[model samples]
Target: MPDKPAGMRFKVRNENKNALGGLATRKQITIYFTQAVDAPSMEVLLYLPNHVSGPVPAFAGLNFSGNQSVHPDKGIFMSDRWINNNQKGIQRNRATEASRGSQASRWPVETLLKNGFALVTAYYGDLEPDHADGWQTGIRTSLQQELNLAPDQWGAIGAWAWGMSRIMDYLETEKRINSKQVALTGLSRIGKAAVWAGANDARFALVVSNESGEGGAALARRNYGETIAQLNRSFPHWFSPAYKNYNQAPDKLPVDQHQLLALIAPRPLYVCSAAEDQWADPQGEFLSAVHAGPVYQLYGKTGLGTAQMPAIEKPVGETIGYHIRTGKHDINLYDWQQHLAFAQKHFRKKAKPKT
Candidate 1:
């Protein structure tokens, strides 16, 4: 058996930008950063609560495409970086269209605003689409030399996580946001990125992973759906070259997704899956959550409240939350509903001051 890697520490860094300075006492401020990508640059979607007489909590995630796709907001301009579905950049494995605008409905924006929180998101495509050479064309190109020394230098997953960190940079500039109370979230591949981001940046108060299979919340040793070999062949650029060698040799790999989950220990973490999404291995997802629960327990917080996986549509709550909803491989309103409810239970609700 290979020795597991010790949990690594990371520091967050973002360019100084109070760009939205005075845009609003407490209002939404969206900013676009020009990463090294050729066509479309990256954008940050922000929702700042009406300035409470105090700072408000927030959640962040990586969107699948450009921010424009999220809500069809006329305010969001068309992205030049949009990779054609049949063309390059993992657009080949496009998500179901219905999933779009669906997340907005389930997230209960009003619930969050009323409860004193804000939400922010970034399109992962801007950093590096899940493909070979994705790193050479995106922000990672600029960061290669600095990050290459380490054997586990950031790969596709690291690039996406780095993008999340950049979003954090923008969040810090907003006076209305309590950067200390921010949560990082994502689904599937981006879900994996959220875990990496939260682990690397302690500033992220919470982490939520939904259907992040295999390299995500699932134990690699399980060699379940989306095995290392399949991942490399399908999305060759998402992981380091070192990861490729471990395709059929999970037992020999130094790390498993459970350790990735554990990396978020002592911090609030939630893992969710769908019953029908067997390819993503929902069971493995739940089991990994169960395994990581012990680490959270070490810090005096409840990890998962139980050991057995619950039925679809039935969510078991704990500091380390887990759920298996009825669906396929995609994020649904049901998932967002649970996430909002979970966030409400654990996060502090900052009340707006009297007029």
Candidate 2:
């Protein structure tokens, strides 16, 4: 593992057994920096399969809505934290009871539990909200003050990625989780964060991106859909101020998404897209994975060998995986199934047997 970043601390706020009808156990963890007593803290929800005998592999990621939205359990905290007001079940930056379990279909908690994997999630808003001024209300503000970082040093995506790393740090201490086998995953913008987190932290055994185009797994030079100009204009806070300079000419940028994928070389990475989600540039994402093949080859590992994208629902690759499923811009059981299968292929040998 890489050298641990400085000044991080974790505390388990609460834990309960027989959560979700005895299907799993749940723990609420708090992560903060030790340098500043007033530093912003983040809340993470961890669910472990109840029937599993020993430490199990887990999937960790940031969620778009409140933690309660992932499952119907009322025990899950309802986020009063800042969030994109546009999301369902959210109004005026707060989550309503109606929003609970709104995203359950996409999470597939039951399937994960049945398959003997743990699920760890945190609301992205707990790191930073999805607006330009969101930094003022989230971890970025405290981190900037504590670390003495300049405003342009990082952005919302970086903060979210850092939150994921903090979660991993806490997982390393858990006796019921195989921290080394934990996979990082997310959808759309959060998916971009997952890739960035995996790129920066080698602790993650697998990384999965679901329709994370443009600044994610898709080549910015392709300019197929959601160009730099549009993204910078629509979501200026997503990247650093320096990133805006490339809006008019992406080719001039020093790096592209292919290089981002290459950063995760030798580690299993999966990039998924939807057929109707052209705004994510499905072809561009596949091409980036293809371009990253040589880097994997440097480690004596195979990447997605085909220059062409595969048929709908047909996932391809060894160390690198890509697929454009038959649907729109949303994660469903199909995407999760592929991710679970990929994790099984790479982690099964190291996984502890279930009692």
Candidate 3:
């Protein structure tokens, strides 16, 4: 992983007032590694609680569509970045006002603000778009020499994970945000990025995976839904070129995803799944957490306390939280509610003084 950039700062393009009816303040920030205008930059949308007495806990993650699509705020700077053509409210591969707040249901900004948690999100495309050719326009090429990965090294997910670290750099500058309490969260493929980010950067404090099966928290050896062969075939750029060798041969690999979860030992990790999202292998998701228990035990911390999956909609586990909601393959209010509850539990523990 790249060392945290020194002298990193963000420029406040505009501050939107009366956001969520005065419950929070919104800002669109353009972040840079240095003062050079031509250098690569990332745009992040921040929603900070107005009623909190001190620095608030926060969620830092990547958005699927665009920053503008997270909320229907006319004040939000329409993202000039490339977007998927099939995305709602987008036309000509660019964001339009019509696409505003289209994914707001997944975000639940008001709940975060009401519960005294700040939320910051950036368009994943800002780092690297999802297509095979996306790296040509995003930060991948610009960071090639900087990253210096081998031919077998994967840049796609790593690039997006690196972007999350950049977001952490920006969060450290915000006085109203308790950077130490920040949780990195994501859904689907981005959830895979979230785990990779948390594993590499301990500064994340907390990591939440919402239905990030397969290449994410799920064990490839399980031979469950969404096989390794399918992932590389469907999303060829998501993994390293060498990973293709493991296709249909997960057992031949030296390790399974339980080892990946072990990397987050002693820190809080939450694995979420949906009952109906069979393709994501909800059971395999729970089992990975169960198998990772030994690592957490080494630190005198807890992993998922049981090998058996919890009843649907009944969240379980201690430092390692796991849940399977009775729904489809999507992020919903139920998922956020459990995350807020889990964050409050672990983060509050850290806030306490020890004897």
Candidate 4:
């Protein structure tokens, strides 16, 4: 993995244990660079299971809306970060009071706590807004200057992925979290970021990509659902300039999604898709996982071993898990159920010698 960016600093801005109906403790962490005073700062929200006896494993991801929208907690701060104007409960690129708990269905906090998992998340817009000119207002604008990176060196997705690693850095310093058992996850575009983050950072014990199609888990060569052309047109700022060259000639691209999946070899990776979300190309996502099996075999670990896509609602694979749940392009309790089962198999700490 790439070395942590030099001179990165973290501070606990605010922390409150009495949160989430007394089921979880909330902490807000501020991360910034010591040298880049002008850089935008990142604030991450961590919710630890209050009842856990020890440091609990956590699930980290980028949220589409502000952190307050994840749950109905009056104490949680609402982000002023620029957001997509089209997102639910967001108006004029800002989140209002009505936005709280708007996305609670996707993030089942109580359920995750009951299952012994902490939830760590931050608004993706804090790192980079979802617009072509967003770099001016997000972390990337300052990071590019600090690192002397070219315009094409990285994109919004890369910035979001790097933000995940920074969050991991903070988790490593906290005593209430098992940094080694943290899983990175995302849905849709952020799902793409989760996969890229997992591939670039080995510290994440598990990775889950929910409907991260096209530029995500789906094989780019398949040209099925959202193609390269469509992605570049719709979200040009998501990838590097080099990626756009393959819009019409994907076959000429040196790397495919399988290679990206291979980068997570031996590590437990879960790629989920929805039957009704044809735009994400469920078949291509499964095929990419199947192709990544060889890389896993090199480490004596198994990947999704089947070539044919399994029936809807039936999950498959061992170390590399996948499922095509019967739904649309959204995350739900069913997805969390599968994620918990996968983590239980791979990330659960071993018993203490049966003493």
Index of the highest-TM-score prediction: 4
- Estimate, for each residue in 1-355, the C-alpha lDDT of model 3 and write its tens digit: 6654554568888786678778889988998755566767789999998887788889999998888888887777788888988989888898878889999988998888888888999999988888887777666676555555542366578888989999998888888889899999999999999999999999889999999999899989998999999999988888878888999688898988878988988899999999999999998889899998999999999788888888988899998999998989999988998888889898873322111
Which tens-of-lDDT digit does each residue in 95-130 have in candidate 2?
Answer: 999889999988888888878899999998888888
Better of 1 and 4 by TM-score: 4
lDDT of 4 by residue, 53-136 (tens): 888899999898889889988888888877777777788889988888889999988888877789999998888888898777
Alpha carbon deviation, residue 164, candidate 4 (Å): 0.7
Off-target runs (Cα >4 Å) in candidate 1 are 1-41, 51-53, 84-111, 145-152, 350-355
Better of 1 and 3 by TM-score: 3
Window of ten residues with lowest summed lDDT in model 3: 346-355
CA lDDT, candidate 1, residue 201? 82
Model 3 TM-score on a 0 to 1 scale: 0.95
Error of 3 at 320 (Å): 0.6
The better candidate by lDDT, 1 or 3, is 3
Indicate the worst ten consecutive residues by lDDT in candidate 2: 346-355
